[model samples]
Target: MKAVLFANTDWYLYNFRRSLAMSLRRQGYDVLLISPPGPYGAKLRALGLRWEPLPMARRSLNPLREAALLWHLVRLLRREQPVLVHGFTIKCAVYGSLAARLAGVPARVNAVAGMGYVFTSSQMKARLLRPVVRGLLRLALGGRGARLILQNADDVALFQQAGLVDPQHIRLIRGSGVNCAQFALATRTRSADDERPRVLLACRLLWDKGLDEFVNAIRQLRLQGCSLHALLAGTPDPGNPATVPEATIRGWVAEGLVTWLGHVDDMAGLLASVDVVVLPSYREGLPRTLVEAAACGLPLITTDVPGCREVVTDDVDGLLVPKGNSEALAHAIRRVLEIPGLAQRLGEAARLKARTQFDEHIVIEHTLEVYAELCDPLAAPAESSP
Candidate 1:
């Protein structure tokens, strides 16, 4: 059977779900990937996977445009006639599921990675759209063949409380899994001889992501004469209203607060260069940054919110502070860096967690089982072809 996986951006397909698509192909499903046109689209195609660009306006609410986009998807689905349709993120999930229903598709899988901009952002616009999006979620996912995947228990509860999807159809899968083997490093760059501890926060540079808090915490640490270096990875997401301006990032770099390395593709190398990985985001659908850091045997510092909490057990594998509290974040960073042997304990536990829980292979298997529930269960995943 043919499977089509769709997302709002090709970057999401490349960075997050590339493994899933390849795994589906290996299991003898003819896979086709779709997203808005992007540089990463070519990269996906280069991986010997079929990738097509589709027009999707992430923030558009225009009636005619929305109708046209829906028609476009409906037409494509009718033409392609894929048996399985999987969409990532809110907009794509709603749209893909709706189109699948219209086109008479057999199995529809929607992965809402996180609550996304609508539920998380406290801005007036985001708040206004929540009820409407929730309504659409009910319409899209309430169908017989539809399945919803959430990354954490908090989200699962939120959806169930909101009466969105049928509880039976929703599944809790951890964040798109991290490649533990790739991120594994023999030793972190930080050593006793090192002058300063290096901490890295990598994510879309967004205000709600706690970018301001991270900077503020770094400033507070510096004011206390803490000689720790900070590194900011990832790029500002233009699609996100909460995106921080490049000027703001430059200002922080100019102030000697952080070395801004925008969009580092070599994550393993980057992880090796830093002693600690932090994501002070207000919330997450299980931030892969922390998982990758955990896989690298690095201690993580993040907010104690839902998605973040799933990967970290307080004082177990990683440290957690209240969301939006920079002072607490600063103290946590200091505690991890300065307390002798604490970082090692946390890092070792985190590595074990990654290997046992967050490995990509585990996610692939669970996801395929979900697929099996909806489609042909007898279609065994054969030995991976060369």
Candidate 2:
């Protein structure tokens, strides 16, 4: 059996789903990855998976370029002619599914990692692009052989309401679950000087991700004499339209209210050191930062949105503030800090939840089930190879 996995960014396929591909390969399936060449292209090849580079661009909405991408994807699908195709992220789900449909692939799986920009936009441009993408989704999912995989119920319902995919075709999986073994908890010991109440925000630094709201909340907290420390991690995403400005971030650092750590890889350790993990993202399929933080037994504070709500159980595992409300965010931050015992209780609850519900094996198993359903029954065995 053979499977072709499609993604718009090479980094995503390399960093996130590489394990899934290798797992499939171990199941006696030949894996072919189709993505635009990226920093991780050589890494993919090193893993012994076949890589096919396509000229895919992220965050670009040029209609002409998009059309060209569709045609190019169709051409690749025809050439590869794999038994099954699996596409990740929104662009790949839409375009790759359509191309696979056109190429007459036996089965296809479209994984909705997150309902990103389109769902969060209000501008005329966003309004114009929304229907076009939705229309493509409808076309991609119109066939009986296609299946849609959603990370969260909210996205599934949204697509259902939009008439994109049938309920029968939707398979719900927890947001690419974290490896519990990898993110172990640490001792809560700290010196008096380092014991100051601190909150950490970890994600791609984007304005629409509620970074501006978070900063504004810190400023509000300072004005109200909250006497807390705010820390920001992650890098500024240059390709994204909503990325926070470098100057604005530097200015926040200058104000002495927040410390910017840029981007560091040791996130599990960072979660252990902080008092709370906060993500005021406008939307998410499920923020991995929150899951990792919970796995490390840290309390969470996030917006009361779809994916955010899934990780946090308001007042149980974490606090849920209104989305885009700086004052509400400040109030929640203050409340969590005032009650010393609350963070401990919340953290304990979060850790239990992570262990019970978000195990990584669940994701791997469900994905493999999809692959099994699409396997070519007549394919020759290794022993029968000529």
In model 1, which residue pairs have backbone atoms overlapping below 3 Å?
A: none
The TM-score between candidate 2 and the true structure equals 0.92
lDDT per model, in order?
0.91, 0.83
The regions of model 1 sitting more than 4 angstroms off are 185-194, 377-386
Off by over 4 Å in 2: 185-193, 376-386
User: What are the C-alpha RMSDs, in order, of all predicted structures?
Assistant: 3.5, 2.8
Candidate 1 achieves a global lDDT of 0.91
What does candidate 2's lDDT look like per residue over 1-386, in tens digits? 78899887787787668888888898888889988887787889998989889987887778899899989888888888888889988888888888887887878888887876776767677778888878878888767677888888888888888778888888888777777667764555444786687799999898767898899999998888888779999889876667788999999999897899998777777776788889998888888888888888888999999889989989999999999999899888888898869988998899888877786777788888766655544343644788
TM-score of each: 0.96, 0.92
Among all windows of 10 consecutive residues in model 2, the one with the lowest summed lDDT is 374-383
The worst-scoring run of ten residues by lDDT in candidate 1 lies at 377-386
Whole-model lDDT, candidate 2? Answer: 0.83
